[model samples]
Target chain A: SQQGEEDPQALSIQEGENATMNCSYKTSINNLQWYRQNSGRGLVHLILIRSNEREKHSGRLRVTLDTSKKSSSLLITASRAADTASYFCATVGFMDMGRRALTFGSGTRLQVQP
Target chain B: DAGITQSPRHKVTETGTPVTLRCHQTENHRYMYWYRQDPGHGLRLIHYSYGVKDTDKGEVSDGYSVSRSKTEDFLLTLESATSSQTSVYFCATQAGGQGETQYFGPGTRLLVL
Candidate 1:
């Protein structure tokens, strides 16, 4: 079962517009990671924000994590058509259990039109 | 793309038949995982292996089983295929322990009819 739930099930935007996706989890986590899955492709790691860190950025991608609220958000500035994909947030809990390795969110489908 | 690869990228099988999917990796990572993806269910772990001859069940392990006879190969087996088991299966590997970044393979598309 998925540990995180993503909001805005689907989004459509122009190439230059910004895209934002939100994820909420139920328990504490060691870190929160974002991944992108292109159509008919495997998942690619994006950015990882530790529980101790409030915000982190990598190029056009920005991620913010709020442990108090148990939520995280990924923001992509100046989105491009290449950015069109399904975005998922995976939560890593404190347990070192391999079975509980990564609980991914339902994901948000973003379509960036050129 | 990681050093991981899943064999038989696409497969179509009949119900009640036994099917096996293979995940091979060149990285020699210690941890390997098997997950199935469906329309509403994002990704659910079916099983994982920490090392050779060492495997464990995941949340959705009811219909599946796994085996790791060697470090670089992990195999997932469906004792009896069903229509509901038709989904894209992904294989992932992490270098170290839990919480480490997982590298995913291209995935295998399985259709059970």
Candidate 2:
């Protein structure tokens, strides 16, 4: 079962603009991570934010996590054509045996047109 | 981009036949995972391993089995392939820490007819 769900199943933007996507999960998570996938290929890890952390930034990417609402959002500033891809949010939950696995959201397909 | 590789990037097999997908990593990551992606289902975990010979099931592990006999290799086996199991499979490795990231492979596309 998928524990996370991302809104705006698809998004289209122009190059040099900003793109934002949102994700929501059901259970308590230790961390939330964002990933990008190009077409039919595999996923690439973008950024990870811990539950205790509210916001983080790397380059033009910004991620905000709200533990109270069980949600997280990713913001891409100054988007480029190369940034066109499918973005997904994965939740890392705590298991009883100190183990953890990622539960991914449905993903948001973003198309950046130049 | 971790040093992870999945074998048989694309495969087409018949139903009731056994199929195995291999995931190899050169990063020596202690944790590895297998996941399947469908059209609208996103990605679901199939199995994962923490160490050699230690494996556990995931949410969609009913028709799949996994083995990790080495630190760099993890194998996912489908006892009997079915149409429902036709999807892209991805392998990932996780860095050990409180809030670490997972690196994914290029993924294997499997089609069961």
lDDT (Cα, 0-100) at A110 in candidate 2: 98
Model 2: per-residue Cα lDDT over B1-113, one tens digit each: 57999999999999999999999999988889999999778899999998889898889999999999999999999999999999999999986664377889999999999
lDDT of 1 at A97: 45
Q: For all the predictions, what are the DockQ values?
A: 0.72, 0.81
B40-102 per-residue lDDT for model 1 (tens digits): 778888888888998988889999999999999999999999999999999999887444888
Q: TM-score, each model?
A: 0.96, 0.97
True contacts kept of 1: 0.66
Error of 2 at B56 (Å): 0.4
DockQ of 1: 0.72
In model 1, the Cα lDDT at residue B76 comes to: 95
Interface RMSD of each: 1.4, 1.1
Cα lDDT for residue A62, candidate 2? 98
lDDT of each: 0.91, 0.91
**RMSD of each candidate?**
1.4, 1.3
Candidate 2 local distance difference test against the native: 0.91
